[model samples]
Target: MKTTLQRIGMILFMTGFVFSVCAQEMEVTGTVYDAHDKSPLVGVTVQVKGTQNGTVTDVNGRYRIKVEKGNTLSFSYIGYLVQEIKVNKLHLDVYLKPDKVALEEVVVVAFGTQKKNAVAGSVMRVADQSYYLPSVIFPYPREVNTEEYEAFKENRFLSTIQHPLSTFSLDVDGASYSNIRRMINQGQMPSKDVVRVEEIVNYFSYDYPQPSDGYPVRIVTETAVCPWNKKHNMVHIGVKAKEIPSETLPVSNFVFLLDVSGSMFSANKLPLVKASMKLLVNNLRPKDQVAIVTYAGAAGEVLPSTSASDKQKIMEALDNLQAGGSTAGGAGIQLAYKIAEKNLVKGGNNRVILCTDGDFNVGVSSLTELESLIESKRKSGVFLTVLGYGMGNYKDNKLQTLAQKGNGNHAYIDNLQEANKVLVNEFGGTMYAVAKDVKLQVEFNPNFVNAYRLIGYESRLLNDEDFNDDTKDAGELGAGHTVTALYEIVPVGVDVPVGNVDKLKYQQTKNDVSLPKFADSKELLTVKLRYKEPDKDVSRKLEVPVLANRMNLNASQDFNFAMAAAMFGQLLRNSDFKGDAEYSDVIRLARKGLGNDPNGYRHEFIRLVEAVEQLEK
Candidate 1:
């Protein structure tokens, strides 16, 4: 009995010792992040609340510091708002909001600078410091052949571009109405009441030059046998815009003319727009400017011009913008233009960025009225960039016209990544118009080319007469921009899509054997481009050519990349020209042609395409 009691006492003493040792030691660990992008933030200050003991975040925004079990932790960064958290567990997730007054919240406004508080209108600004893969477009769709497609999958090339190449048209529905004029003049005629699809796509991206020094953005361009008409070749081109840092690059005057009409009440409409705007706001720097102008039955500047420095005021204005009443797009445009004119700044970035579901229902609803209104104000030195959001009953037609006549660009935001792509990843190129009144003319050589069809740009084809007219307005290009076009050529011996004359009509045709015969023209297509510096009234010309040949679709990466883009566009619009095009085939070609995906935009596109397919189902 005595021996047993002694053993029990010893056990108690050891147990108590163990407990004391454990109580004396505690671990505090957590992951820190930059509030802007939930990306891990390194170099942040982490300290015990009210105590001097603290540690900085490591490379991955991770930290481990010894502290009392119940000690509160304070997290801080130079440009971010500080945060306090209780240490409940060893592993924790900490997010730090941006500092409201530290670095000026830069908002890109039209032509000037304003404190965030003074700016009026629904404005979204973004600041991203990440990198995305570069988007490389095939010079022409026929660059790819089957052999190259196979080679791309075998690690033959280090990188490749994605699909859905950029397309911009001033008139949304102009593709169907002005084909002949567009082909000659390189300018699509204005449509009365329809939206142009290409303009919507072109509005967001700037024409930044390809990264010449770094890894060249690789792309597979291809031409394939048209599934519906084997007599013609289908060209595909792919593009992927690389991501870079978000910093104090340029100051822009941004007027957000939002459409809050009753038609935009759908879940994806106003709500998505608001969210998108917020994301952009969170990205602003203190040096930028922004304003909010909303149109619903009437147009009003809810917030005056303000600097990005005052975020609270800017955010408050954004929060106050509500959706109601009919859409008075013209009124909104006029007010926005007025605000822009008053705040015009020379040599600085000036642009009004409009966000809408493309639905305009109320006053001055005609496209002509809106276009004329926009055109008159464009001379005031402010440019336009249109962002189309939401779906269903969308008025793409009007938005396209506004962009074309206003000397601007257009884009469609379907998801958050795309929102980032436009607002954060590529802000400068999107908001700053480096070149204006841009036009493209491709003169085909009748000698070498038997027949040819320009795949897209049905609306952008221009008349030769309009080329030199300074009064004629055209598409605008931003800094470092690239423009691509595709032509499906039909050789003399091949049966092409060109219509055949009736046998009876041909029988009556006299075979005139002219004594003077000329050699067949060797030129395939002559591409002539005219553009003006953003602030200039004159135009400059650049010329290139589309060579004639039976291009191996798989032999060239450019060919594959281009075809993929064309097919993707066809899928999006479901064009009447698609005939027998299939999404499955698009996927197959893209998979075989996809090369090094640095930014994952191509991968995301594939997912988007799949999602679209599912929705179709």
Candidate 2:
């Protein structure tokens, strides 16, 4: 981390307002400025929520808009943060702060197939503390083939009696699996960091029943003998997000936040983004509104918010984009969110679809600043979907941070087919939020099991207390999405699962105060889930207790295939708990679970296992 951030600031100059309410409407007026130095900010946009009425701030950082008393007013500016206020009979003044991640004076070369002129402006890079400019100009640069990932250790087995509670956020991200598949297809061995087992397991949907109850997500579980570790018991836990029909889903407000940086000048980057976004655009209902924001040298709104019925306007905006300039992700993010907030949808699905390689080389380019900005903006009720493109030079770490911090999920679009799978086939799940901050906590009964290990989800683990904390952020579940987790349990009487740790010395014994209660409970474990409604702040909780039934010789088809995917993950990562796990066994389990194979995703999983087998050979 740097010692001090260069307090790049923004300011709002406020003049008092009269109760001047005529027919419940008033002329809302305000000015935006640079907070650090009080310099007037030009081109700031002030808009009334849920309406097309808006105006831009002049060079004096002043603007006025007439809106209703209860309407929300959005103040937005490039390279700065956004401020929103509801109209009341009070003083009208807001001091906007700087988006530290604001893009500086960055430049990029715009090259065509034929020779093109070099960019003229000097590109800026950040230095710690006080600033000094030693201008360095270089020619067209060579592409850097590098990628970043979130590093996490595998979950380990814990004694049921010692640590009876297991808690983690339920995640539906499938980026890791498709990303690994891309590497395998290209004959590259996916490193450990590149493999997230939960994502791999969640790449395919299971036939988990939807919520029949009033809740938005339903929890289902099936018990089966562990495929890799035979003596161990495996439990497949599935949480299915309620599916809202296309017509039933709230009208959407979308902002396409695209990265057109120099790094994105590849076949799989900007071009692919345009194509992928078109698929989503075609799926939007006529009532939905779409806007385009692109960031490179500086962030700008390429297309104003237009109704989806005008498909040609939206399509042309995406088609006209060309990749260039240094990454100004901060500016782009703020602008996109600003647009989404300006066109706020009451009880509707509002989202920002960010297409990027996640590389930010210039313009307030610190990850911490970007994260802080995103966390603050999520309160506006707009969801986020991060579509990562390109391979080498990919910043998965940044994508992960932006998505998890916001009400969002991340997906890597390596090819057009994967793009179709995410944006088209699963449009409902990809674009609509059925539930947010969904978390699961499991309590293992000492009487039913000796020890248990949760497969994958190392990054999504929450503190045991977080399950009940409404303020804690968890995973966001989209409409019709299913999040599955597997736990390998060692029944009380069975030999300790392979790679066993020493018996947990909980310090208390059979005569201890807690021991008698463990012996009294007949249930195996209880799965509790907590989630917040899309429009509410309070959380709702649901739980289902499983009895200590014997392990089944036959399991649900979905359970079988999910376990197969889990086994494949263990083998690929060479997990410590992978007892007797082999590629052949993974293939067999996958084959058994290929019930209907609706989308042939199971077949793809089997092929991935074979690819890994060949790699090992």
Top candidate (lDDT): 2
Candidate 1 Cα errors over 4 Å, as ranges: 1-249, 265-267, 500-512, 515-521, 549-555, 571-581, 608-617
The alpha-carbon lDDT assigned to residue 96 of candidate 1 equals 87
lDDT per residue for candidate 2 within 451-543, as digits (tens), equals: 899999998889899999998898899889999999999887887644544545966554366654645877889999999989999999999
TM-score of each: 0.61, 0.75
TM-score of 2: 0.75
Reference-based lDDT, each prediction: 0.55, 0.78
List residue ranges in candidate 2 displaced over 4 A.
Answer: 1-142, 495-519
What is model 1's C-alpha RMSD?
A: 18.6
Instruction: Give the Å error, residue 164, model 2.
Output: 0.9
Worst 10 residues of 2 by lDDT: 122-131
- Write the residue-wise lDDT of candidate 1 on 524-604 in tens digits: 445555667677898766555445564554434334444555565555454555556677766666565456655564554
